[model samples]
Target chain A: DTAVSQTPKYLVTQMGNDKSIKCEQNLGHDTMYWYKQDSKKFLKIMFSYNNKELIINETVPNRFSPKSPDKAHLNLHINSLELGDSAVYFCASSEVRGGAKDRGSEQYFGPGTRLTVT
Target chain B: DQQVKQNSPSLSVQEGRISILNCDYTNSMFDYFLWYKKYPAEGPTFLISISSIKDKNEDGRFTVFLNKSAKHLSLHIVPSQPGDSAVYFCAASDLGNYGQNFVFGPGTRLSVLP
Candidate 1:
């Protein structure tokens, strides 16, 4: 069984269009994240949700919003996508423990969603 | 600012040879480091990791060495095979923070020549 999974492996849309990427994890992890990899292969974290609550929100554009219906699912919604939004979007999940340092909790990533805004 | 950085954009190595990938970090608060490997059209997979308390960690043919003083770390793959040819990324996290936010570096593409 796949530990982490994302839907719509590939997304192609015209500029100014809006879209959403769905992510699900069967690992029963409490933390989920969204990352964007640009053409230069630079990966950056966009958002993170812990226990269905928004935790980390990097200085991303207002158009990009993340919604987590439950601890097992986190979806990214992009409004008025631009050409610059073309990139590979990755979904990852990690297990977190309170008090004790969770340094060894390795993140498991999904296959990724390649978004192309023409 | 890019907290984690991989200076070498790409590297080539002969099959069965040792492949070393380097990473540097500027944040002293980052106490844990991880290495991930990614193939074309796929998300990166976790390979290995190391804690600040330990300078070295090994798993099978993969090993990671951390230099806290220099703020540098490296991933070594022994007897690298063609199947190991992929982009490798280094990530770091602040142990003090419960958020577990990871900072990743620009990946280094490894080409294993047969």
Candidate 2:
């Protein structure tokens, strides 16, 4: 059973085009995240959602938006994609302990979606 | 500025040998650390983790050591097999941000030769 899964593993689109990537997790986790790995191989967090509520929104451009319809799914939508938008996007989920002792909970990642903007 | 750093971009080791991957962080606030292994065309998988409260954490052949004073951590793999060859990433998070702001290092590619 795959714990975390992403659809449209490979996507190639022209500049100014819009695209969306879907992610789902079966780990029964309450927290989900979207990360972008650029050509430099740096995995940076773009957005984070807990129990269908936005918690962390990084300094990402307004063109990228993340939506979590439910606790089990988190999707990323990019508008007016540019050449710099070319990167691999990953979806992750983790169980939060909550309260006082919110230690680092290891995250489970999906296969990743490779996006190319021409 | 990069809060988490993995200096060595790549490391090569022979089969049955021990492989050590080091990571350093500039943020003193970081209290929790984790190591992840990634294969080609796949996402990173959680390997091990250690909290600032402890200096070392062991899980089978994998062990993680944390040096709070130096703000450094290392992952040790014993008898590394060829299958262990992959890109390893070091991630760190603080209690204040919880798991939302996990800063990941650039990653280091490990090659286990037969």
Candidate 3:
């Protein structure tokens, strides 16, 4: 069983076109994240949600938005997709650790969705 | 500015040898550090993590060491097999960040030669 899953493993689109990638986790985690892995293989955080509430937005472009229906799911939407948006998008989740005051930073990641904008 | 960095882009290791991947960060407030391994066409998998309070943590063949004074951390793998070859990333999270937001390094590709 997959702990975290992303839909449409490969997304190919044209410039100025919009697209969305979906993610889901079954690990009963309360937090979900959206990350972008660039061509140079640098994985960076774009957004984060806790219990369906928006928490962190790492100075990402306004054209990009994330919606979380529940803690189990988080979806990323891009408006007027640009060639620069072409990269691997990853979804991750982690539970709130009980003992640690810092919470759990051990994230479970999904098979990334490779988005290509032509 | 890149707060976290992995100076070495790649490393080659022989079987049964130790593979040490290093990471450095500029932020002293980071409370948690983690190491992740990734194979092609897949997302990073968590290997091990350490809290600022502790200097070391180990799991199986993976061991992570943290030196808060130097703002440095390293992942050591002993008896590295061919299966251990992958891109390794070191990540950190600060207490001020929400929802476990972590900053990642570029990554270090480890090739374990048979």
Q: lDDT for every model? A: 0.93, 0.93, 0.91
| Tens-place lDDT digits, model 2, residues A19-59 | 99999999999999999999999999999999999989999
Model 1 ranges with Cα > 4 A deviation? A98-102
Q: For candidate 3, what is the TM-score?
A: 0.96
Candidate 1 has an lDDT of 0.93
The sequence of per-residue lDDT tens digits that candidate 1 reaches over residues B42-114 is: 8899999998889999999999999999999999999999999999999999766666889999999999999
Identify the runs in model 2 with alpha carbons over 4 angstroms from their true place: A98-102
Model 3: residue A107 alpha-carbon error in angstroms: 0.5
Candidate 3, position B110, lDDT: 99
TM-score of each: 0.97, 0.97, 0.96
Clashing pairs in 3: none
- Model 3 segments beyond 4 Å from truth? A98-103
Q: Per-residue error at B52 for model 3, in Å? A: 0.9
